[model samples]
Target chain A: MKITNVKSYLVEDIVKPFTWQVDRPGSGDGRDPRKNFSCVMVLDTDEGISGYAKGPKGRIMMDLVERRFSSDLIGMNPLNSEKIWEKCWDTDRLEEYPLYAMAMVDIAVWDIKGKKAGLPVYKLLGGYRDEIPAYASTTSYDTLEEYRDVVEASLSAGYPSIKLHLRYRDVKTNAKLCEKVREWVGDDFSLTLDASGLWNYTDSLWFGRVLEELKFEWYEEPMREFELESYKKLCDKLDIPILAAECSDGSHWNAAEFIRRDACDIMRTSTHYKGGFTGGMKVGHVAEAFGMKAEVHGGGHNNLHLCLALPNNTYYEDLVIDVEDIEAKGQGQLKFENGMYSFKEQVAGVGIEYDHDELETISIQKYEKF
Target chain B: MKITNVKSYLVEDIVKPFTWQVDRPGSGDGRDPRKNFSCVMVLDTDEGISGYAKGPKGRIMMDLVERRFSSDLIGMNPLNSEKIWEKCWDTDRLEEYPLYAMAMVDIAVWDIKGKKAGLPVYKLLGGYRDEIPAYASTTSYDTLEEYRDVVEASLSAGYPSIKLHLRYRDVKTNAKLCEKVREWVGDDFSLTLDASGLWNYTDSLWFGRVLEELKFEWYEEPMREFELESYKKLCDKLDIPILAAECSDGSHWNAAEFIRRDACDIMRTSTHYKGGFTGGMKVGHVAEAFGMKAEVHGGGHNNLHLCLALPNNTYYEDLVIDVEDIEAKGQGQLKFENGMYSFKEQVAGVGIEYDHDELETISIQKYEKF
Candidate 1:
C-alpha cells in the first residue's frame, strides 16, 4: 500500500509518572538529574491506525528529518519498507545523522503497514512467539533502606529478576546500597548491576567480580559503551553477561559481532532506541542465529509487542517502572501476568491510546504554526 | 541567562525543483510533495541574544518535549549548557525514551549558552584545537574516466587527499571501483574507500588485502559497523586502518567503546544526528583522546563551524555537499582556501540565517508553536 504520512509528536506522559535515577554523593542526598525521563514520539497513518514509540526525544530526530532528509521520505509505498530503509541509509550522507530517528520513521511506517496488511508488525518479519519473558530493572535508590524497599517491592510484584543501578562515586553509600539490596532480595532471585558506564575497565572488572559473588544475573553497562575490549575482557574473565544498557542498537549487528567474535552473550535493547516491534523482530533474528540472549532494554510504553514475539529473549526488564504508571489507556494493552507481561487480545496498532490534548499541555510551546 | 523561546523550522528552498526519494519499497519513498532542504529546531533565549540548536523530530523525541520534558527546560538558566544537559537527561522517567533527540535539545540549549557567553560553541567545550584538516569525500563516478575528471578537478582545486565511495555489491564491482579509482589517482597520490559496510568479514579481509596490495590509503566501514570482530579481524589480520562508519555507532558511548576496543583508526562522524555541535564536539574529543583522526561525516553550512576551532582532524568530509540542497540562505558562508576550509571571522552563533517564508514554502507546515 502507498504510505501517507510521517508525523512526530511530543507526548508528555504515559501512565507512569516519569521515574528518575537519583545518584546522591552520600546517604540521604538529593537526586541526580543527568538521566531524567524526557521526550517520546507517536506516528499516525492515513488508514486511521497509528503507533507510538518512545525515544530520547523527537526534537533532534525531527530536525534531521524535516530539515535535511524529509525529501528522502515524502510520498512512497509503505509496504516496501526494506527499500525505504536502504534509500534512507543510502542518502544518509552524514555518518552522524541519527540512525535511530530514521529507523523510527521506518518503524512507525511499518507499524502502519502491518495494520494495513492486517498482520502484526512482528509477524511481518516472521515472529515465532506471541509473548516474551521480562525481568525487573531498578534505578538508584537514595539509601540502603530505600534500595532494599524498592528491590523487595519489585520482586514481590512478580519479576523473577532485577537489575540494580550502581554508581561508585560514593563508595560507602554504594556499598551499603548493594549490601541492603542483596540481603533484602536474598539469593534465589536473579539480581544484576548496571554501573551505568561510569567505571573504567579495571574498576568495573573489580566490582563485577564482587557482583558475581553476589550472583548478579547480568552486569549492564558496567563500563562505558566504547570499551569493547573491557566488555570482552570482562565477559571473557567474568561470569556475568555484559548488557548494552539503553544503547541505541536497533540491529543485532553489534551483538552479532560480539557473538561472532566470542565477545559477549547478552544484547540490551529497547523499543525507544532499538526494540520497536519491527526492530525487535529483525534484531531478534540475528540474536537467535547467534545463540545469544536478546535482553530487552526497558523504556517508553514497552508492552508485550516485541518481547512476546521474541524467541531468544533472556528476560523482559520492567525498568523499575510502576504499574500504576501504565495509564488506563495502556493498561489492557498488555497484561502483567504475575509480573510477566502478555499482550492484549485486541489487534489494535500499538494497542495504546495517548491523550492528545494532555500531550499538547506538556509541550513547551517550542514552536507552533501560526 | 533564562531561556525564553524555543523555535523549530521545517525550511525549504523557494527556487529549486526538488526530488524526494521515490523508490519507497519500505518507508517514505519521497512521500508527498517533493522539494529540497528541510530543518527542525528548538530556539532558546533570554531577553537578548537568541541561540539555536538542531533538535530531533518524530513522535518519540517530540513527544517527550511536548508531553512533560519541556517544563523542565523552560525558564531555566540558558548559560549552564552542561547543567541543562544534565537536567534534560536526569528528568527522564521512562526506561526507553529516544535519547538522540533529547540530546539535541540539550545541544541546542548549549549553543544558546555558547552564544550568550560570547564564545564560539567549541570554545565553550574547552576548545582543544585551533584548526582541523579536511579531505574531499565523494561517490562513485560513472566511469574511471569520469572519476579521474572529478579527481583531477579536486587536485586542481588543491585538495591534498581524496576519498572514493565504493558501492560494489559483488567482488567484481568492489574490485572494479577500487581498480578504477587507484588507476585514475595513480600511485603517488593517496585515497580511501567507503565500503558503506557492504561486505562480510571474509569479504572484508579479502577486499582489504586487495586494497593494501593496491596501496589504497584506508578502507571505511569495511565489514559493517559494530562488527568488532570483523573490524579487529581485518585490523589485526589485515594491516589497513579502518574508518568506522556512523551506522555502526549507536551513539557516542558506543563509538567510545568502539575506539576503546580498538575498533577503527579514523573516526568518521557527522553533526547531523549525534546532537549538533555539543555532542559532535564531545565525540571529537573522544576520538582525539584515543589518538584517532576525527573526520566530520557530512557537509552543510554548520559543518564549517565544527571544522573550525577544532584541531587534530584529518578531513572535513562531506566537504562539498549539494549546496542547492541546503535549507539556509546564501550557501557561501563556508570559504574553503585550497582544500582547507576557512572559518567565518565575522559570523556568530552558527552564522546561519534561516528564512521563515522559505521554510513555509518548502515545508508541509505542521505544528509551529509548542
Candidate 2:
C-alpha cells in the first residue's frame, strides 16, 4: 500500500519529570534532562491501514520528518521499507539526519508492514521468543543511600538483574559504591555498570578491574565509543566483557569494525539509536555471527519487539529513572511481569495503541504532510 | 519462491589472458594477473525459475557460497533481497567475506526477483536510464608511448573519455605524461587519472596540483583508501575532485564518513566491490543527496546495470586490459557501442544469459548445496 500522508504530534508533559544521569554533577558532558514532551508519528496509507510510532521528546524530529523526509516518503509503497529506509538514510550524506528521525520513520514503516501482514512486528522480523527477561537499568542517583534504595526497590519489583548508571564520581568513590551494592545484593545477582562513556583509558582500566573483582556481568561504555584502540586494549587486559558502541553512528557497519578489531565483547543496539528495527537486526545478527551478545539498550515497545526478535539479545533494558516511576506513563501496551517483558501475541503493527483523543487534548503542536 | 538450491561452477580458461595492470612492474604491491577462469553461480528455485550471475575468477567464491552461505539461503524467499543481503553481510562479522562472494549471491537473488517480475534488474532498482556513456579505464602500460597508443585506440573506438592508470613512476615523470596526454586530447576530452593508491600525502598533493592545472576530470585513489585525514587535506589543497574509497570496506557507511569529512569530491561504487546492487544503490543515492558524482568502477553486466540504475553515477568504466580482449569471453551479453554501454530491454533478470553447454565443457570444479 502506498503511504499517502505523514503526521506528527508534539504532546507536552507526557512523561514524568526525571533526572537523567548525563545531566548530573561530575558527569563529563553535563546536559539537561529530557523534557517531558513526547513526539508521536503516524503514517497513513491509501489502503486504510495506518502505522504509529513514538519519537524523542521534541519538535525537531517532527519538523525533520515533515520538512525533509515526508515529501520523499509520500506515494511510496509502505511495504518497501528497505527502499524507504535507504532513501531516508541517503539523506544522511547531506542532512546528517539524527538517528532518532530515521528510527521513527523506520519503526513506523515496520509497523505498517506488520499491520498489512496481520502479525506483530516481532513475528514479521522472524520472532525468536514471546517473552524476555529484563534488567533494571538505573539513572544516576544523588547519594549512595539513594542508589541502594533504588536497587532494593527494583529487586522488590521483581527485576532479576540491575545495571547501574552511576554518577561520574571519582573511581574510588564509584568502586566503593559498587562494593556496597555487591555486598547488599550478594554475589549471585546479575549486575553491570554503564559509565556512560565518561572514563579515560586508565580510569576505565581501574574501574574495569574493580568490576571484574566484583564479578559484574559486563562493563558498558566505560571509555568513549570512538576510543577503539583503548577498547581493544581494555578487552585484552580485562576479562570483563566490554559492551560498547551504544550511541555510535554508522549502525551495523561501525559495529562490524568494533567486532573486527576485537574492541568490544558485546555490541549495543536499539531501535532508538541504531536506525530502527532494520539496523538493530543487522547489528544483532552481526554480533550473533561473531558469537557475541547484542543487548537492547532502552525500554520501549520497539526495543521490546527487538528483544523478542533478536535471537542473540540477552535482556530488555527496563530503564529506571525513579522507583516510583517504574510503571510510568509512556510504557505503552507492553506487559512487564516478574522481571520479564511480553506483548500481545497477534496484535498487528507495533502493538501499542494511542488514545488519539487524549493526544489531541495534550498536543502542543501538530504537523501533517502529503 | 524459495531458493531450493545454490550451484557454482568454476570454469577454467573461460576468458582471454591479458596482463593486469597491478601485476606489471613499477605497479606498487604487484600481483599476478587473474587466471583465465570464471565462476558461474546459479540459484535454483522451487518454482523452476533460476537466477544467474558471475563471480571473480576463482573457486573461493564458489566454495564460500556452497559451504557457508548455501544452507542458510536454501529456505529463504529469493524476493527478500534486503533480508538476504543482511544475512550475507552478517557473516562478514565472523567470516570477513570478500565483497565479490556476497555480490554474486546478491546479484543472483536480484536476478530471481527480476525474472519473477518480468523486468530487468535495473528496472527492479527503479531504472534511471537505459544507457550510460562509457570511459575507457585503462590498465597501466610500460611506457608513455604505449599509453598514448591505447588512448588513441580508445578514442578511435568512439570513447568520449579516458582514465589513465599510469605506472607508479616519480611525480615529475607522471606529471609530464599527464601533460602530454592532456596536450594530445586537448582541454575538453574528459581525461582523469587513477593512481591506484600508491602515493603518500605530500606526493598526492604535488600530483594533485599538477592534475588541477591540467584540468583533469578527477584524481582517483592517489593515497590509500584508509588515509581519510590525508584525503581531507588533499581535497582542501586541490581543485581536482578526489575519488577515494574505491576498494574500501564498510560500503556506504564508510563512504558516508568520507562525504561527511569532505575527504573526497567523488564517490566510487560498483556491484562488484560495494556489497552488491543494494549497496551500490545506497552509495550512489548517498552521493546524489550530497550533490556529488559516484563513478561506477570496473565493467561487466552487473556494473553496467548499476551504471544504468544509479542517477548520480557519471560513467560506466569499461576496464581495458587489452584492446583486442575488450569483447573477449566473459563480457556476457551487455552491448558496448560508440562510447556507451546498453543492455537488452525487457530482458528479464540481469539480462545476461550464460551458456550452460560451454560452462560444462570448461568446468574445473563444481559445487551444489540444497
Q: How far is each candidate from the true structure, as Cα RMSD in Å?
A: 7.3, 23.0
Put down candidate 2 lDDT per residue, B1-370, tens digits, no spaces.
Answer: 7999888888654333443333232211112223344578888999988999887534446546654667668899999999988777655532445566688888999999989999988888969999888888887776778877887778777888999887654789889889999988888999999987667899999999899999998999986565566788899988888998787666777677688668899999989878889888898988899999998888877888898888888798887765664544235576777777897446898877777777677778788874
Strongest candidate by TM-score: 1
Consecutive 10-residue window with the lowest summed lDDT within model 1 chain A = A24-33
Q: Which lDDT tens digits does candidate 1 get at residues B1-370?
A: 6776555554443332322213211112122333333335565555666655444233334444444445566687866666775555433323234345555575566566666666665566555554454566655444556556666666666667877764336766668767776776678777877776666787877888788888877788865565665676567776778878465443466567677657788776656545456556777778888777766776654565666645655566643222222222224666566556655464445555455566456555433334
Error of 2 at A200 (Å): 1.1
Badly placed stretches (over 4 Å) of model 2 are A21-34, A327-332, A355-358, B1-370
Per-residue lDDT for A125 in model 1?
Answer: 51
- List, residue by residue over A1-370, the lDDT tens digit for candidate 1: 4444444444333332332344322111012223323333444445566544444444555454444344555455656666676666555433234446555656666666767777666565555566555566665544556566666667666777777775345444565666667788787767777766566777777777777777777777765454465667888888777776355343555556555545566776545455345455566677777676776666333435566557677566666633332222225455676656656664544545557677667754232211
lDDT of 2 by residue, A21-133 (tens): 43232211112223344578888999988888887534446656655567768899989988988777655432334566789989999999998998999999969999999
In model 2 chain A, which range of ten residues has the least summed lDDT? Answer: A23-32
Provide the overall lDDT of each model, using Cα atoms, as 2-decimal numbers. Answer: 0.57, 0.78
